[model samples]
Target: MVMAHNPKIQEALDARDALASAITRAGVQLPAMDVRTPWAADADEDEEREGDARYALVHLGVCSASVAVLLADVIVRGLTS
Candidate 1:
């Protein structure tokens, strides 16, 4: 089944890509980063549509403790500088 084009999903994908690029430049990696599909998890792929449902979320996923500290430091430096 071919699903209709969903701009919302595309937006989420674009955001994920942009964020991943930015994080790479930041010298960190989020191995599990992706778009959250809880809202459409139970639906068929072709049935995934944006209606009155909530928009998909960009999952930042997890990182190691040291990576977390590094991210925090990067954020802090960005904020202060």
Candidate 2:
């Protein structure tokens, strides 16, 4: 669906986009959590790798939050329309 047709969804998407842009502008280079799994079952990795995993978790958290907003908007629209 075209987000422009729904003002509330469009606004939410815009906010998410702005947040992602702001994170980029802050020079925090986050990896693509959507493409890669954020964690592993084995917990024997080195400290650096663990740190990277933690960072990926943070990125995933942000991505999940944005997705939740979008999903909620879509669900609400579907039910209401």
Candidate 3:
């Protein structure tokens, strides 16, 4: 089979891997644990900057988890059919 090299997909995969490493270090799952970003804040430029940084990194975990859930649902439906 031929494989396509997509930069965004590769980046997302790399990010997921990094998050996995961080989660392993933190000793918590992305779903069950409240993973706080280092730059989280309530408001203002500083807060926005921090929140943006955190969200950027953490969003990968969220997207990966979402995809996993979707795939699991598809598998369940396929099995039940």
Candidate 4:
């Protein structure tokens, strides 16, 4: 059975890719990720579990975005100095 693609997963992937690109352009490297969460793949499972997973992923994404912004700021400062 073919399952429909999950938008949340795509959004998360896009965010990660964008952040990686930004970091690369800034000549900064992020440490390799040690944890992996199957965000979309587990969507069809239990409702409570899926909700909790989604919440956690969203929180992680937010934290990543903040770090990306901080990196950009540091890069800007370095270039200006």
Among these predictions, the greatest TM-score belongs to: 1
Task: Point out where model 1 deviates above 4 Å.
Answer: 1-4, 40-54
Estimate, for each residue in 1-81, the C-alpha lDDT of model 2 and write its tens digit.
222334444454565566567545644433442213234554445633422433221123444565566656655766799
Worst lDDT 10-window in candidate 4: 50-59
lDDT of 4 at 65: 64
Candidate 3 ranges beyond 4 A from true positions: 1-4, 31-81
Of the two candidates 1 and 2, the one with more favorable TM-score, higher being better, is: 1
- In the range 1-81, model 4's lDDT, one tens digit per residue, is 111144554455566667667767876656542223455565666643422334222223233666667777878898999
lDDT of 2: 0.44
**Against the true structure, what is every candidate's RMSD?**
4.4, 15.2, 13.9, 7.8
Model 4 error, position 67 (Å): 11
Per-prediction TM-score: 0.72, 0.33, 0.33, 0.45
Best candidate according to lDDT: 1
* Cα distance off (Å), candidate 1, residue 40: 4.7
Model 4, residue 48: distance off in Å is: 6.6
Model 2 segments more than 4 A misplaced: 29-81
RMSD of 4: 7.8
